[model samples]
Target: MSNDRREPATDADERTMLEGWLDYHRQTLAHKCAGLTDAQLRTASVAPSTLSLMGLVRHMAEVERSWFRRVLVGEDAPPIYYSDADPDGEFRLTEADTWAEAYATWQAEIDTARRHAADLALDDPSTGRHRRTGEVFSLRWILTHMIEEYARHNGHADLLRECLDGATGE
Candidate 1:
């Protein structure tokens, strides 16, 4: 697979191009999460931050579900990470017993997010309110947010993974 990260042109087909960028980032994050031991997956290498590979996988799962299902669709869906419970629950993975389980969760969330993005018309704006602050946002804004969030997190993952092992991005 090519390591180059330049997104496909947006002018060709805006929706496809946007989705491609999102999918590329999702894959990049997964690539960083792959090939690790249980201990390494759970290790908090970034001091004071409990951001492990497993935790990031869980967090991404919540992010995909919450954004694609709840926010974009405006469904009366329960928040994936927190629902008046604990805010930090997204990063907390008590049941990430095995690496396989964690990866499966991440993959399932990714599939759902992809389907949600595919089902939308690029011109149609999303109609969900932000969980906090009660602010409403459009699909374009959400997609851009997701792309930015993943890009930033993937950069962090690059350094974290490199420190965990000598591996760098392809």
Candidate 2:
């Protein structure tokens, strides 16, 4: 049988459950990205939009920092790679940007996300409010949202990796 990216367990609590799913999704993205050359990863054969695996890596790192550090922690967390002038900059790559660096940043951001998340209970509310709705989100909402974000992007990573080297898997 194929190895499950997500951890399997029946008796896990809420936080553990969310963490497991999120980690699984994160690892899935990394697995899809394994062994790709920088140029191959930069290929946006998916077309008009530049959503390469490298872009996804950088984007997810930004997402984690924004949610966990900015929204949840209420710290002055800003975009790490992308900015107002070039929001899609993460996907815009050159020969210099290595997959190794992107993956390293992604893992570091994941660790930071976990570190920040562990200090709070699922029921705890955000230290900051939502920008659009002006509402404070519960930790439960953030966990679920993060999982959803990774789930969607990981699907894209699957397709991108497949196009890159004919490699595919769950």
Report the lDDT of model 2 for residue 168: 78
Off by over 4 Å in 1: 1-11, 80-83, 94-96
Number of colliding residue pairs in each model = 0, 0
lDDT of 1: 0.74
lDDT of 1 by residue, 24-131 (tens): 888888788677787777777657887777777777788887787777777775655555578777565554466787688778877877777676776566677667
Consecutive 10-residue window with the lowest summed lDDT within model 2: 1-10
lDDT of each: 0.74, 0.84
Give me the candidate number with maximum TM-score: 2
How far in Å is the alpha carbon of 54 misplaced in model 1?
1.6
Model 1: lDDT of residue 119: 68
Worst 10 residues of 1 by lDDT: 1-10
